[model samples]
Target: MESIWVGERVRVRGIEPEESELLMEFDQDSTFMRNNDRLHPPRSKAGYRHYLESGVGTPNDDEFGAGIESLADRRLVGWFGTNGIDKNSGVFSYGIAIGTDFQRRGYASETIVLLLRYMFGERRFQKCDVEVYAYNTASLNLHQKLGFVEEGRRRRSQYFAGEYHDVVLMGMTIEEYAAAYSLGTVESS
Candidate 1:
């Protein structure tokens, strides 16, 4: 059943039970959690097991999740998913969390490109939207590098790390994706 979404350096597939321990590392990373605007304590192995068993990475009605596996070592590097899918509007929002060790390796870029292919090419979605905390300059830069335009910002809306910060809103349309990656310019691997 089409389980894997292949990219050049990484492939995304369903999260596995055995990888529960690895998944916990994301929660353990205080910086990663803060960037993603999360504050929950780390989940136990059993909790992770329960989460995987709950079919998180499996395709659902409106949203879906998947684990990013690096091709170099076939290790689960991170995860991403779509939420707030609007069928009528043909718009969707997504989030991603890459392990600290896996950051700044172009993995996030390729993963997002792969997801754009699925959402815009396969599902025929019109636009993809994302919100990044203002302090996450890396993410904001990555989004712009990938051709996502800064639509606006919610000033001082998100409170964390002892102060409030703006929520940077970004979006990419299907036309923009086609232009950026025309003829599959983004090399695989």
Candidate 2:
């Protein structure tokens, strides 16, 4: 699980203290967090330091980064990871965000695909889930493209921009992931 994952022209490696600055790709960028319903707000450098240390500080925790060629020579682009794992039920949640400079290139979707493969195929998790704001078309589209189905809607759950917003819950079980990825179904384009 510590080995770096390479796919879709990017590399995903376990998070490190070096990646503490790297986390700004997800934490400080509000636009990136738009689709990530469960993420807490952006934090200052010290705040982000504490946050990353507690969440993925352990080498065994499996938090990782998805990065590509440098902005100039070679720069880390973004990150994605899992959390809230219920070991007994094998259910867990996920988060992802590409850098503002590196987004819209299928990186987020690819990250989810690679991570889902690791979770369902390698780790044999029973299910994996993610939540998105109801209005986030990109995130909703990405989740469905990966075979996650709508599970429920949690109404009026978040307050932002001086108003409340509803959130949608979606999930995919190992069976669904296997069926979509393992079978290699020809998805409609």
Q: In order, what lDDT does every prediction score?
A: 0.86, 0.68
As a whole number from 0 to 100, the lDDT of residue 157 in candidate 1 is: 94
lDDT of 1 at 78: 92
What digit string (tens of lDDT, one per residue) describes model 2 on residues 1-189? 223255645666545556667776455666566555445655777766776667543545444433343323345667665787787898888777667767677777766777877776666578987888888887788788878999999999987656688888999998888777752233355
Candidate 1 lDDT, tens digit per residue, 1-189?
232277669998888888888878778878888897577866789999898898766887448988899999899999998998999999999999999989999899999998888788778789999999988999999999999999999999987768988999999999999987742434345
Off by over 4 Å in 2: 1-4, 16-19, 25-28, 37-55, 61-74, 183-189
TM-score of 1: 0.91
C-alpha TM-score for every candidate: 0.91, 0.76
Candidate 1 colliding pairs, count: 2
